[model samples]
Target: MQHRHACERRETGGDRWTEAEREAVARDHRDAARRHRHRGGDEDRGGFRHKTFVRRLRKCFEDHGRFAGADLTRKQALRDFFEEILLRRRLSDHHSFTLLGDLRDAPAKRFPGELTRRARALTPHLLTTDAAAGRASSARPCVVLVEADPASSRVATSAVATAGGEVAAAFSSQKAAASVPGTVLAIVDVPDRGALDAVDRLVAAGLMVVATSGAGSVALAVEAMRRGAVDFVLKPYTPEALARRLAPRFAEVGQHVANASEADRAKADFGAFVGSSPAMLALYDEIARIAPSRAPVFVTGESGAGKELCAEAIHARSGRAGKPFVALNCGAIPRELMESEVFGHVRGAFTGATEDRAGAVEAAQGGTLFLDEIGEMELSLQAKLLRVLQTGEFRRVGEAHARTADIRIVCATHRDPQVEVAAGRFRQDLFYRLHVLPIRLPPLRERGADVETLANEFLKRFASEEGRAFRRFSPAAMERMRAHDWPGNVRELQNVVRRAVVLGEGEEITPEMLPAEVAAGTQRLLLERIDEAEVEPFWMTERRVIERAVAVFGGNTARAAAALEISPSTIYRKRERWAELGT
Candidate 1:
């Protein structure tokens, strides 16, 4: 039986408490109040007793206790129980649930059209989307940030998340004076000398600390680095600045294995993307070759093939690197609102129009405008976009003034623009103007062993994300991945790896942990066939299979041996003999 006498009911249905049982509940409320009056707790805090009772009940259930003769897992039982307790008329307070605030199960209040009318006086602030900002996120660094004030903490938190850096935890000065283990970095917002000790504590715990402060706190910023901080940035933080500072750290995993010459750092990395394939290397060279040009570039690729990353890399390496890279998805916004989203609207321009707003073009002034899924844009909007490209001017909705946007255009689409033009769905003139420079990205299936390389990088990244001990994939699991054709490309691989990290508890991932569809695909792997007509020697065929498996599994000798059903020492000796032969 439940410990609360008021909550206990003789009826099997929780909501069927009779008038006599309600009287018993009212009496219990009065008796509890009488006992409370003699104690040192507040009597005016209206829903205190009910809240305390609910919390205690939840705790008891979590600690392995159960209500008498009742199955808590049944949906109706829980619903009726909450309804009875929450709706009960208390003898101590008239309006029982008013004190529960927004937590009460009720419809949210709305001012409707009145709020829209009032919003005409309010203005919305806009942030510049640097070309770097328009790219899809790869992996975020796991880090903590400390701030003394609530307002500053919230500001810092938003900046970190926007930049693809996960803030693991936020702490104030009064919290536990320690840093969390396994955190890659900590950004400390030091208000004064008092907070300096916290930075030192984090450093002593073997964490990399970055100290930050406002303009007036230069002395503190300097002192923090002097004590132990690895880096420093001034306050009034922007996500772009932080991203640029940590760019190297984001690509550190690929850099460890990237076999690039000193003259070819550009070949090894482009924004957040990293790969060692010949196609990727060639793409990197092409991006580097065109960074100085202001000509409009149209990037074509299958979905999830990193078209946005290509645009971001060009912008990051170009002259407009300091300016915003504004990205707008043409397919995502409605045709009616697309005008307002791409161009600013003055207040009273429409029904819910607020004050003045800067559109993506204005935000990208002197920078780059990345238009994703441009093929999906309405034909009418395409004409308007062409005008902006022809002449650097565009007017706001409901305004006569024509503003000039000095920005470079970087457009991407998975569809063929020429096909769209031939079908009359896209304007022919606009296609010619934007397609001055064309770059094509290859699909993941054609990238060969890069699938395993990308998968391993994701493993390390998501292991940090989910706070678990996930290391590598078992040999059979790796072989399973190498055989399946990833039609969804890199993005699909990222999601699968993240899911396995979240769900799999073992140190190494096995084929059983794969998604149902992927596991089915693994059964259809194309293996070599043997024939008596004409074939290579048995030993040479075995060597070739071993070599192919080693390449696909990222050159792991042990994993290759397991996949080939051979001993690790055998493969090791074979490699040693091959190296000696220099064949």
Candidate 2:
């Protein structure tokens, strides 16, 4: 019972609550309730009701505080709501609270039983003054944001705020040294050794720290780890990354909401990859959640769905971001040379080995190694890769000495690893080793509405690159694109736009520039099914015949008119009219 009480005290706080102190806090709360009921005026609500706020408050409370007792539960809950929501200032005495509505009289103590009843029902019965009593004052275990550099502070602050954390204050090393009490976690934007020293000091003070750097070195990271940082975030990172690193730690301390709403907010694009579809957003959240670890990450996506982009984002968010990000395409390398290419060879080891060389593992020392098309690597190489992953030990080709790489492995393949394992093409043990955190990217076709957005982005980029006046997609073109099934995914879309930007002339890219199957849409399907029964306006039919003839003859106007039995000038006039109408 003594041991259990010690643990409970730690949960509530380091100093156990005295019976007098609990009664004092309970009395303070009752006085505040009285003031709210009698003298205080209410503020107007735009659309949100106080009840709705109460529901959210309870949900956040349950998420952050898993308090396990009825003895002081009401006091604890009311304290959390006031501190976390209202952010009320601590009383001058630090032993009790001030009443609401500027009631200058000191709150008088009430009987213990009455105090308990009022505290129990306080949250639901909170008046406008009770909840709005104090603003922006704080207490112990507050999460602090420390960024010395003024230029980068905004980014770091925005990241932490977007993650749903209540930042107590922003300070530098000077201010931190001045005020170090009761900080839960300090996310320091480290730009140099001075910041590292601050981190070490904070750690020494028993404050958890997350060190962030934009252009950091391996020495900084290693030293930060030695000084006891919980995690390291590379700068210019998304808010989700900062949030994820803090999430689990804050959950343990009863300062974070590790719920679905927070996870869903991370659905926005991460780094270079763009999408808000549930799957992509989930992938972004997963990356943010796992980027701090040194575990091997396996990424799977169809060809051109940007698997490599995901790998880069992971490496960027990880502690190893300051080091080289070496990438190798296992399928692109020759089978016979794969071993030497990965592990390297000494001079004269092979016919082409003119001098000693290092491979991907060595090149990526103290960083990340991204292996694309991993499933296509030969089976013999798979065993060697697995061995390295298992023991972090490897040997160079034709060399007696062994070598090890301090590198994180990120493997990617378009084919399903399970299917490959079943077929005996991929090694089962190797798959398991690299599959600790698997990120499967959805094909572009499955991400609805993202297609049009992606199309607009691509078109805008290509327009500037090609120096074209092209701006928007015509309504007909956008509808056709949205309806068309993109079998080739993002890569195919990029290529189609690139071709159109090069050949297209008008401001609006019309259906004429789109592929036959894509542009025809409903009409194309009808034509394919009915063969000869499809009808069209006379001019439209003429236009189709001329287009087919010109396309077939490689844009030779004379040949096209000859194929259609029309004068060359007549075909030219129709083409000019179409161009004039921006079609």
Candidate 3:
């Protein structure tokens, strides 16, 4: 009955709650919260008394069933209203968390927009303040106008602002467009070849460029496309017409521009890492949360997955940012001199020890010591290292007195430490001591579009170093790169991009310019898919290979097994099963 009355009242009130209705609903909520408190249920934990909150939410839904009008979807309308209410009410953090959690866990079908603004605005410490700031900055899409004439630029800026966008900056030259940050798009009036070159630079900076050319300058339009302009418009276009034409492009690239801006911001915080993928962002958040601590951090990842960089990031974020960060590669050093490398050597300690020398630990005093490939450290050394960690003291080679150590230990290993422990190659206690805080880096293949971000960054860097004209990757080359499984990870990708920049002569890198291995593999996979009509069963294929191997080995199963890297008993068992199946 109350829901029906609310709906009728809402219908009469022109699809919006009246001031009296809002106060009545707010009063009801407060009364329910008071009742919950009187029932001995903590307000912080209960979060608006779940049952009553849902009842109110459903009532609002019913009253506002047609509130979306035609332009706004029901989901968006609910979210906008909810956000406005939250802002007006100024809910407590605990209440907001509980409310957002319930909304987050609910099915997306029931709520579109997922209350993204609300969740981002309410998430504790993660995006709360930053999200608010981003919201403010993104209230209007920002456009950069690159027109040489002052009067024309003023006109364009006013048009853009009037068209529901903000003029982030107005530059008279295309050369200045590349430096503009947090822009959705750039409007470039290309009158000459120099402006066309500027279009290239802006595109290289990841901004979508819209080149405006005179109607008779068909050659200029063609050149603009070649120079990487996404869309070109003929001059003498009106604000409404231009806006209509560019609206679709803006919608398409809006999210991408936002992400690029976010990545740029993230670069300021995580200097060594260059990605905004969810995995990377989560990793960044984790690093920030854990940076202030003094616990030893153990980083584990594939050889080129940036374990050392992760350690550096942790150190940079920690209290030791201003201190020295000494890194030692345990695998690169010889086992015979491992002890002397970790602890400084006294004079006359060995044949080469002519004078006193400080090792990595000493060099890293009051800072961080990054030990890469630590699993390669011998058991004897591991035991000694464990003592230093426990006692905070170490003795130099051939020294009788122990020196105090005041440094954080951050160790990394490509190999599994547990496997080394089981093999008795590493001390168990040392592993435990360093493994207090463990960070596992995801391989590049799993980082998704981060591959593109990293590839572009590497291209820009290497292109300048090599003094090449390489500006960007051709679409085909980029697709092939994203398709390939990067076995060697980021290091391999870096080398590939560097090689392409060195050998390629054109402004855009093509598929042929890529290393033969990556290009050929892509072609081979495509050919395999197209040429193979019938797929053979795994057992048939396995039998064919095994039969061929046995024939090549003169019918000796053991020799074939040895060549195939499988047990001879396993081959015999497979042969018995094949015979029974009459294959």
Candidate 4:
């Protein structure tokens, strides 16, 4: 009875009791048990609880006897419990113990070391493989496993660790952004659509992501790629396959880091613009001719036709290349703040203005100011702009003094200035002033055969950004690209190429990897054109025939008319009329 009480007291005191106190308790328990055995007392075996107590005491004695020479701590007791309950149950083969509480607060010194020893003992067989265990232990790159399902967490951790990566943390989508660090690669098991928000946050932080799910939906995979995942591995992945998939990505990540180290070495080479079409070459020539001059250049093109790039080229090649090159989208600024943004403003000029501020024009002094979407500017502001263009002088809001403008202006617009002037939406004088050195950028469709070159360029850029090993597009994919009309222009083409880079599973990008809208739109348009049988007006039919012939003849108008069995004079007249009608 005395020994039973002593053992209970030691168990209750836990790690707070010293080893000497534990030994004293054990001695007292042995003395009482021996006395009870000699007396053959049925009182100790009167109930099941007494029997269980005796059994626990005997097991403790056996464990202590086995490790009698070594010192034992309360943490070792806990570890033994874990090995019996968790490890024996196959809950986890390898343990990565992260101490949650401060060691200074620990009641005993040996607790931490005992726990560490136990974890070392359970190291799994798979972790001993050469490819799996050869990574640096101190500088291990963090691999975050995001899984809401408890059942898959162990499997994911084991597989990732076997691939020479460490599972830094595990989190559900709801907690991923807050828990994941920037350096960690987020591996998400997105089981449903609700997890997309978590995926989006990970992407916004610029963390490399790898998503998986049991569902084999290609749409989900595509969506994951669109949200900036580096790769998507389906569930039930073997350790070898997981390692193979991650190996190249790890190498590419190393390259990206190396490249970033020498980022300044990469110059904005004008030769980097990838296109050999006549229109592109002509635009390049125009940029070269006008870059050295201080003229107010006007760029016109459909949206996403690289008008801003043309502006950049001009600035980069000009004397102002060494100076600041400021760019602003006229359409993006709020109407109420447009004047204040363009010209200097004094304190108290507006609600949010607490101090005097220089406007964009003054900010670009001695440099080039690129005004994108200039047609979106209000007509009232156009007159003030014309004055600045004519006299190079302007005044700040709520200020009495006038300031001289010393900046060069480069403007771009997708709208037709003639149409805006006819509609009384733009001042004709301002239009004429801006049109002095007009340079119209041809759209992607008009660039003819440049699509493949631009696609490959974008493919390389996005692949490098994503840390993938994709090289090029398949032949069928290239044919599909050429067959489609890019209504969103170059921007659309860039997005498609980026999407393909992310979603492609192999080195070559396939048509199946393209967005359904792109492939479907081309097919639908082709079918619609083929099914059309209605006869149109003679002029309309003539225009259609000429357009088709021109496409077939690769934009040779003379050959186009000859193929249509019509005189070149009639074709030219119709084209001139079409141009006048703004078709």
Candidate 5:
């Protein structure tokens, strides 16, 4: 009768609690709170209440803890229950249950009906979450505990489970974490500096990490954050506190992994470039195809659009990878010294030529010579550069004999080569000479979602270098960055991130931390809204934009296609369709 009454007080019901029963329950609540407060002693900031933890453990076992046919005792069954259900740890070699495959590979009926129903209910949300961010969010996201110490791992696993998240355990290798299919958020134990490499590997694999360290290791915690841990907690943290810290990030990464489109999770890196957008992938393909040939590659793009990096990638991919790659900025050099800069000069060739110096051509022998801002080279120097490209031989200044040249030339300019040729500032012969393989880099605004990818990468690198606490950008800042027209391209974005890391405090980089120009860019759209009566079909707007582009280039669909960051074939196809529709 006493046990029944106690159970009644514990369960939720209006059974008319006696004064004695009421007092007993109140005392229990007070004791639970006190234990929760001091469970980890002086070092622990917050902790799980032992009574609550044990009660939940018992309840989970009662529901799903079945040891069919095996002669396991009750104590052994309880241990397996804690490991398999609450901790979500894999028991691949267990006699009865083996979670040895992908999360989807597990049979639906393996668990009871309620758990299966819960997973199915989470499916739609998983599909819709953070698709643009390139996260593989179709499966249920798991909190992976990456700790070498078995004790710490168990503690973290329980805490994550207590906070109502699926949990998994991985040790020193972090290979097990990778094997667990789904979106993963890691809780890495940083006992010392030796574990930083594990943090790096997990981050590079695109998992979000929260570093946990014991007290008096603030420096290591900061280093972990610098190494791309999203957040950190001190040792002996409470399940409640861990949940509170993880909630925002969980929402940001889109609740948990769910089924997503292939393109959404495509690899976003090629060579030194970090983007998976169609334009960048196409550019990468083009570069690969052109790198084998000995043709002079001409690159055009807005300034700071990674034109030099493009040149380096070309050099790296070509057969000349072992040779030196010499870069000369034609615009940065004076006209008087431009000739000597391109070709070697003999001692006493001209003023300030006291010693024999090798120019870019000599330095780039058996390799590639990158001439940046070739449009800025004077007409006189253009003739000389053309001579080298044509004859593959050139004399140094004040030299009688011509030297044989063995170098591939890769030139880049911010200005359009055709426009420069037409203006007579650049030689038509030289323009054709270097335009054998033209690559036009798309501006940042046109590369969808790459902006966010780049921002996160820059944040990680800069945070590490500057030892800042910033781990990720706030949602508002990410939106602002995406909306801003990065006129200066990648360089501008790098500078903004560096500034934020050096000056901004806190874990998240907010919009206020960004430059005034970038933050204000959100409101810079030409048309903020269209009235309901004035609204028209999207095709009409697209047609107008396309037609305007074509008209601006004087009916040259190829040039207009380049300007629009689309293919000429696409323009032709769209035009034919529009004609048939007769809009």
Candidate 6:
């Protein structure tokens, strides 16, 4: 009976102490409780009552040496009894299980079957719950985890589903390859080269694969990359870390698929101008307002500020969308042939006019005429264009009769039309006619919080077009992008994002992927100086010119002095003075 009692005590975690030791601990606990109660100083009545109850329980344990003999062999009996008492005392609380205290030195328990069963029961419920919650369309995309081990797969599926991704299906490697669509990006725990071979097959079949090995072998990861795996996340990763790595890729894939499926729907839709910034929203509203009108529209902005895109948007939304929307570059047309190109000519109109032909205006009759670089149009041609706008009629060179065109006109220029008009380079009347609906596009730098949205949109586009698995921009890359002034504007931003997407090998696009000028924020500073120059006095132009030269030379005093045709000492002195003035 004593032996049985000792065994019971051992099972119940009481064997670590002798009866005397137990009594000593109980006395110590009671004393501690009494001290706590006294520390309350009678003001904390509830604390005193709590401490008194604990002291009473300790005293009872010391006196009895044990609780009621209720299966003392059960390791959980004491815990259950304590939990019950805690509930009864209104102290019920859930705490994290301390593995060191709960299972230290105990024989490791294997309940794989129970874990597997629980995961299976939980996974579908989790997926169904997420679907009901309508989380599939949220910004964060979901990943479907697959493993050969049924238990591991179940756990992975449950975790991913709970994270708001639809687990399309989970199976063994062979089954996953056969059953899973090429669109489903697979995350596999590669056990060996054979597992890698399965990934290879999936890749060959045009599916995106991300393989992970808990062992963290570079060989497997490199091999996977070489075999066209989108990313390789090593284990043992927490659910959060894995999700972070996989979500963007999944989102990219889903976005591409959606875009591809709806190509027809998006044909007339403006290219992915993803932004909700106030400026962007306003621009969109402006596009909608003036698109259907037949009035002559003029778009003005910096070089890469997407003036052409605005023109396209106007054309796409206009009543003549189904008709040809012709574009001609006045600056690109040779000066000698600019008149013939604009007005069209008979066979004898000019040396190059081989046959009777139509001008851009005639070609775009009943549609839209897009004139880029209108400010660059020669002075003589500007007079003819003014006549065309005034009368809506033009006679082809050497042709007797005037041909009238019924077309909506859109013109874009990077130069300041008012300056040109004041300088007598452009006709003020023509400027007014073309400026019937003027749209001034803001530079990429001024479009707050739109950089990220535009970057993401470009990433999706280039990834699809290039058949790559590009994902999201890294936080550092995003910061660098936001810091840039984007002198070239949206067109420049689009190119940068496209380049990053194509060149980026990791799941995140880094600052290194950006152009050196943009990554270093040099362009931003230059743009700021330009802005300052606009407000500076005419006499300050010389200083501004020198300052720009210094910046171009990377603040090298000797180089800046050489560029400015001044001495190095002079450059240094000016810099010092500018510093003192806090310019």
Best model number under TM-score: 3
* TM-scores vs. true structure, each candidate: 0.47, 0.46, 0.54, 0.45, 0.50, 0.46
lDDT of each: 0.68, 0.68, 0.75, 0.69, 0.70, 0.66
lDDT tens digits, residue span 327-367, model 3: 99999999989999999899999899999988889899999
Which is the winner by lDDT between candidate 1 and candidate 4?
A: 4
**Clashing residue pairs found in predicted model 6:** none
lDDT of the structure predicted as candidate 3:
0.75
lDDT of 4 by residue, 422-497 (tens): 9998899998887778899898877878898889889888999999899998888887887788888889999998
Q: Note each model's CA RMSD in angstroms.
A: 27.9, 21.6, 18.6, 19.8, 20.2, 19.2
**Candidate 6, residue 48: how far the Cα is off, in Å:** 54
* Deviation from native of the Cα of residue 385 in model 5, angstroms: 1.0
lDDT of 2 by residue, 1-583 (tens): 3323433564666434444443444344444444544655342231223333333333333433334233243334434444533433223322222222112121323223333223222321111221222221243235566766644554454444445444455566555552344456778777877777778777887777888887668888877878899888887776567767777776655534333334335433364875666666777878899899999999988898998888999999999989999999998998999898888889989898999999888889999999999988999989989889988988888899889778999999988899999999999999999999988888886787777878898999999999999999998888788777677778888887888889999899898998887875656445446746566578888788889999999989999889889999999899899899887
Q: On residues 188-275, what C-alpha lDDT tens digit does candidate 1 reach at each position?
A: 8776788888888888876678787774677787799899987787877665576565555435523532454421464345637857
Give the Cα RMSD of candidate 3.
18.6
* Best-matching candidate per lDDT: 3
User: Candidate 3 regions off by >4 Å?
Assistant: 1-258, 523-583
lDDT of 5 at 191: 77
What are the per-residue Cα lDDT tens digits for candidate 6 across 1-583? 3423553565465524344434444454446656866776452222335435534543433333243222322213333333344443344232211211121112224222322222222232222222222323244343434575534654455345444454544445554443243235667778666677777767776667778777678897888888888888876665567667767776778777775545434333556455556676678778989998889999998898788888888988889988878889988989987777777889976676779988898998889889999988988788888888888988888899999988888999999999999999898988988899999988888887878878888888888898887778878788778888788888888899888877778677887888997788845645666764368675367678887888898888689888778898886787688788887
Order candidates by lDDT, high to low: 3, 5, 4, 2, 1, 6
Which residue ranges in model 1 land beyond 4 Å of their true spot?
A: 1-268, 527-583
